[model samples]
Target: MTEGMGDKTEGAERILCDEGLRVAVGGLGDRVVVDVRDGTANRFWTDTSNLEKALHGEAVRIDAHGGYCVIEVREGTGRLDLVMEGVEHKHCDFSTGDLADAIAMVREQSDPEGSLVERA
Candidate 1:
């Protein structure tokens, strides 16, 4: 979705208004990848297949601050759900914080116990 990423990066978009803080939702091969850009320009990537299934254009409750966010697929019509920490929920437009959290959740699921991070 960036200037040169192309369709290979479906569902990938920038979120959060803060400079250097953004996320890309897309896939490589058969795996979905969410790339997070922090304030320091450090990049963190996560795969969010589970989060994508929650449907888009609908309200999703995010755990952080009970914020409302919406999940939308890039270049597609699919939506998503945000079931955040502590079982809180938010429904609204796609956002940087929600995408960041989704990436974190996926990373946690993929690398429970820190094995993946250590191996990488």
Candidate 2:
């Protein structure tokens, strides 16, 4: 959390590194927001949820050459399997589907006998 912003924020933390990058992470009610800014013109903001479940120590790696990225939530005890961790899968699966369809996907995954649709 930033110095003066602490009282106004919840689950917030600000990291200042020797590399001169400033990062802010926090939550507002039900959403998590992250901001990254350098002294230059590279400031950016990324907001999402399920953050509290992925804080303290989580990992996000992008494998450009390998063609895939991995994002995992890590707790003090261990890493969490997102499906079982109860994190909402995706807002649209592609972010353009019907809201009901998205919810149905989550509901389908909740079943013990349901088969997952894997990318081919």
Using lDDT, give the best candidate's number: 1
* Per-prediction TM-score to the true structure, in the order listed: 0.29, 0.28
**lDDT by residue for model 1 over 1-120, one digit each (tens)?**
111112223333434333333444544322343333333222223224434443343333222222222345454333333333454443233453555554544434433333323011
Each candidate: what lDDT? 0.36, 0.27
lDDT for model 2, on a 0 to 1 scale? Answer: 0.27
- Position 77, candidate 2: lDDT: 31
Q: What is the lDDT of residue 74 in candidate 1?
A: 50
Question: Which segments of candidate 2 are over 4 A away from where they belong?
Answer: 1-19, 40-49, 60-120
Ten-residue stretch with the least lDDT total in model 2 = 90-99
lDDT of 1 at 54: 38
